[model samples]
Each structure stands twice: as C-alpha cells, then as structure tokens.
Target chain A: AKAKDFTYSNRGMTLEEDLNETNKFYLQSEIAVIHKKPTPVQIVNVDYPKRSAAVIKEAYFKQASTTDYNGVYKGKYIDFEAKETRFKTSFPLNNFHKHQIEHIKQVLNQNGIAFVILRFSSIEEVYFLEGKHLLSLWYRMEEGGRKSITISEVQEYGHRILLGFRPRIDYIKIVDKLYNLS
Target chain B: AKAKDFTYSNRGMTLEEDLNETNKFYLQSEIAVIHKKPTPVQIVNVDYPKRSAAVIKEAYFKQASTTDYNGVYKGKYIDFEAKETRFKTSFPLNNFHKHQIEHIKQVLNQNGIAFVILRFSSIEEVYFLEGKHLLSLWYRMEEGGRKSITISEVQEYGHRILLGFRPRIDYIKIVDKLYNLS
Candidate 1:
C-alpha cells in the first residue's frame, strides 16, 4: 500500500500547478483571464553590488488576506482559493483562515462569484464549493459544530471537477452550468 | 514660475501612492474590490534561523507581464494599468509595452473593462483612457505615427478624473460614466 501511495504521489501534480497550467491554456485559447497572485514578501534589506543586479539581502513572507487566484470569466468576476488534503474521510475546517472567510463574504456582497477548489488528492478527486456554502460550514464551526465536513456532505454541496489533458481541471465547465451560460 | 512649480510639487503626491490610498478607501466603503498586484520577486535564497522566522537572503525583482490593478465592480470584471509622467504636452507611447497592449486587448475581448490611468504629474491631472482608444494610438505608432499623444488629444479622448478628499482621485465616477451607470 505504501508503494502504491508512492506511485500516486510521483504521478500526481499539485492542485496549484494544475490550475496554473489550466489558466495558461485558458489564456492561450482566449477563454478566460485568470492569474495566481504572487506570494507577498517583505523586503527589509538590499545589496547593490557595483555593476550588478541588486540582491534582496533580507526578507520575510507576508500573510495574504485574499484568495490565491482571481480573474474574469464571461464578463463576471471570479475569485477562489485552492486547497488540497490527503485525508479521504473529511476536510478539516482549520485549512481555511478567519480573514479568508470574511473576504468571501465581502466578495459575495459585491455580487461576485467566489469559491474554493477543494482537492482530495489521495483519492485523485476535486470539488468546487461556492462561497455561500463555505460560509454556512464556517458559521457552524464557529458555533461549536462539527470540526469537519464529511465526504458525503462535500459530494452533496460541491460540484465535481473532472480532470482533463490540457486544462488538468475543467472547473469552468461547471461554472458555466452554475451561472446558466450557454 | 519656479516657486509655483515648487508649490505644486510639494502639494502633489505620486499617482501610485494616491491610487493605493484611494483603493483602501474604496475597500473600506465596500464600493469595489481592487488591488494592485505585488511586484514579482525571484527569491534566490532564504535563511531559516532556529526558533525564529525565515529570512530571504537573496532575491531579485521580476518584470511584470500584465497590468497593475484588477478586480470586480457591480458584478463585472475590471482591469487596468496606471502610469504617471512628468511630461506635460504628451504621454510617451513607450510607457506601455507590447505584451500589456495585447493583454488589454484580451481583457476587452472577454467583455471585461480595460483601460490605462494616465496621470500628468506636473499638472496634477488624471485621465482614464479605454483599451479600444489605446489600441487606435498603438496601431498608429506601429504605422510610423507620432511617438506620443498630445495633452489636447488625451483631453479629447479620455475622461478627466478630478481630485477629491475621501477617495483622493475619483476615477470610479469616471468609470460610472464609461459604463453608463449613475
């Protein structure tokens, strides 16, 4: 079983990388315009060597308040955070931060489409859960509810994103269905 | 004249800082969700100190391929790049790159609002020039046209953004005009 796990791990690309590749394909095909926000870094010090490029001598990673990816889809604003977990039974609520939950609410208030791409990597499956659905679970957790959502609950609430060759994950196809786009 | 120039320079702020402050105000008011993309940096090395935070020891800033700020407003996608120039008579065409023009075209094709925020720093004036208008000039430049657009031309083709106290530059009001939203 461990050897089989190793094989799966070796063959499987990270969900982020897959999404990046998918976005690139979408961009080239003129379907959508999406991009992953760069990791915020705090630069403290820099060294300018004579006749050479300046080097960042000291820096630290800064916490981002928003989601990882966002862009335009069929003239609508789309925003989301991508997360992957190995646990097969359920997805732990701790994976999401407090600020992110609030951000999703704000996006919804502005009438924007916001969601999370949840990947059960061990099972090689992914699901797209809308912001409203995530908020319900988030509020439940806040009120001493279940620590995690069961796999069946995810299946019931989230739309499955089937893997593909070029896009790697065809989540937009599901978006079209959700938005009633032809 | 020199004294007057000093007075203008002393009172005027950089367009970018002004825009950041404006965006912050917009966010606080729940008007729109837009943010300038972080300057991409190529992290070369990092030092993880024991019992302390990791520090980036070496890194270099990377050139950005796309426009600066993007987000959603009124359920529609919005994207734009901002540039300020000291030149009073004309905005140099070289201020925009080839890829950025192409990117703007792509955004427009997808039915998203795309534009350039042109700031004449010396005059303390700003204008919003839409992507289609920008393309016209870009194509003209390609055909060995004038290297820049005169201030008169900008005033004729773009919407002037007046300075304000709350949001600093009221570009959104101009956007309202462009989208025919009161």
Candidate 2:
C-alpha cells in the first residue's frame, strides 16, 4: 500500500477559510483546539426538497454577539475576533462593538485569554492585540480621542503573527510565548 | 408622573421567553455573562421589502458547532448547553452533536466550567449536569450502554436548579458553590 498524501494550498482562500483549515490541521496534530464561529443568520423561511438538500428560501446576516474564534488551547481559554482592514494609518475603533468590548472585559476578568487579530490586508500584515490594549483605546475613543489605533502602536504592543504553512496562523506558538506556556 | 405599576404572572413562559428575560436580569445584576446562542441557519434566498425588515424567504436550521451558552462568570470560564426534554428516565445523548462534545471536552481540558442544563419539561425540573459526568455517560452510551441518563442518576450528580424570577437558571449560584467563590 502507498502512503496517503494530504496537502493543502492557501491560494485564493479567504481569511475565514484559511483560519478554518489551519484550525483543522492543528486539531489533527493535537496542537490546539480553535474554531471560527459560524456566521449569524436570521431565517424566515425554508424549502425542503425531496431527495435533495434543503434550500434556504430566505435569510439575512446578523451581527455576532461575541468574538470570531474561541476555544481551549494549552490549558488556557483563548478568545479572539479577527478583522481585515485596508487603511494603513490605523484600525478603526468602529470595527469593534460596545458589547464585544464588554464581553472581552468579562473574559479577561475571568483570567481567560482574550484578544483581537488585526490584519492589514493591504500589506498582508497580521497582529494579535490583547483585549486590554483595545479596551484602553476604546475607552479613550469614547473620551474624545482618536477613533482608531495606529499601525505603529499595534506593532509595538501586539505580537506579529507570521503566516506559515501546516498551521497557517501558528497563533499557539505566539500564545505560548506570550503566556509563558513554553 | 406616576410610576408605572407592573403585575407579575406565575404562569410559566416559553423556554425562549424565559431565557431572554433571564439574560436581561443577568445583565442588570452584573452576574455571570451568558446568552442563548442564536439558532444557526443556512440561507438560500431572501427578499428586501421596501422600507421594512428584510423578510427571510427560505432558510434551514444548521447544527451548532459549539455549546449554546459561554461566557465569564465569577472569575471563571463558563460554558454550557441548554436543552429541554420530556423524557422522565433520561436525557437523550443525541441532543448533543459530536462536535459539541469535542468542544466541551476542550473547554474542560482548559480547566473551565462546562455543563449542560437538562430540563424535564413535563415535570418542570432542571438539573445542571457537569460536563465530566455527561462525557462519561456519553462514552458509555457509545460502548452500548443505556442511550439516555436517568433522572435519578442526574439528581445524584447534578445540581438541581430552581427556576426563579431573577437569573432564571441561577447557574452561577451553582458555579459559585462548586468553585467556592466569594
């Protein structure tokens, strides 16, 4: 018998797809357990076709109440939201919601790891910004400060996640470094 | 202006209504943060009516990837699933999916609080069964044991929750007791 070959390409994969694939690889390798939340949808009607997959007749996207990805990684509860922006100056505060900030605060209060993944899509740069930094900036914004976080600020405080093969995000490696797990 | 007088009803409300009311109370009380997860749906079609809510024309309910309720509670991570079953003998293991079980195990591995709310609708009884107990029984079922957990067994290991006016589930109370939190 020949050895089975399993390889994947990241070409043309959206951020969500790439993350999903990466998580799957991590799970199979027993490295981490992470999952992208399903898109929230409001459904009003449906059609059940005989001998065919059920078809959704009507629905609309709804804003999510929590972060995008959250799960257990190396004995720590990891929670995060990922966003892609084109602006180089900074990431807009409006990209996050008041409820999400509150939720992240609660997670942090409970001694869990909570953060945001900011992707400068224009330059293909991704940074993992802790919730504390985001919350501080968010409160400052509410108190009449700038409405976004500058790229230079993120570069200083957030861990830069270098994209790679196998586990594309390789966030756990960064998490290990940040949490001193290693 | 006269203060509005409100009358309380003893007649029970639907699970959905109770849950919503409970969530509001939790938010107001600064207790554990938890919310019923919105049902996942796959949409195939939709119609945007003129100056009105977008009507969903067709959609189908999708299986959830993680547990329904998860948040930070009393300096600990809280994660659980809510289910109502009419069966008197036990809760059907089939109520949960494989992915959900995997997710719960991951949460437990991270030292987080994980459990399920089993409501016997006919008897109006609710029990908070810990994830470890549930997982053990689930594995037993997979090994050709009873397909469901008996109410008596649940009563032995699970905390019986009394539905109340505030914090309907009062799950945090059990969590507090279990973890010995102040």
Which has the greatest DockQ? Answer: 1
TM-score of chain A of 2: 0.87
Provide interface RMSD per model, one decimal: 0.9, 3.3
Q: lDDT tens string, model 2, A41-159?
A: 76655678899877777677787877878766655677888887889878998988888898888778767788998888766777889989999999999999999999998998888
Q: How does candidate 2 fare on TM-score? A: 0.84
Candidate 1 Cα outliers beyond 4 Å, as residue runs: A1-10, B1-12
CA lDDT of each prediction against the hidden true structure: 0.85, 0.76
TM-score, structure 1 vs. true: 0.93
By TM-score, the best candidate is 1
lDDT of 1 by residue, B1-182 (tens): 33233222665577888788888898889998888888789998888899999989889987777898988788788899999889999999899989889889988988888999999987777889988999899999999999898999899999887666668766777778889855
**Taking the tens digit of each residue's C-alpha lDDT, what string does model 1 give over A26-96?**
99999898889888898898888999888888899988878888888888999999998889989998999
**TM values, all candidates:** 0.93, 0.84
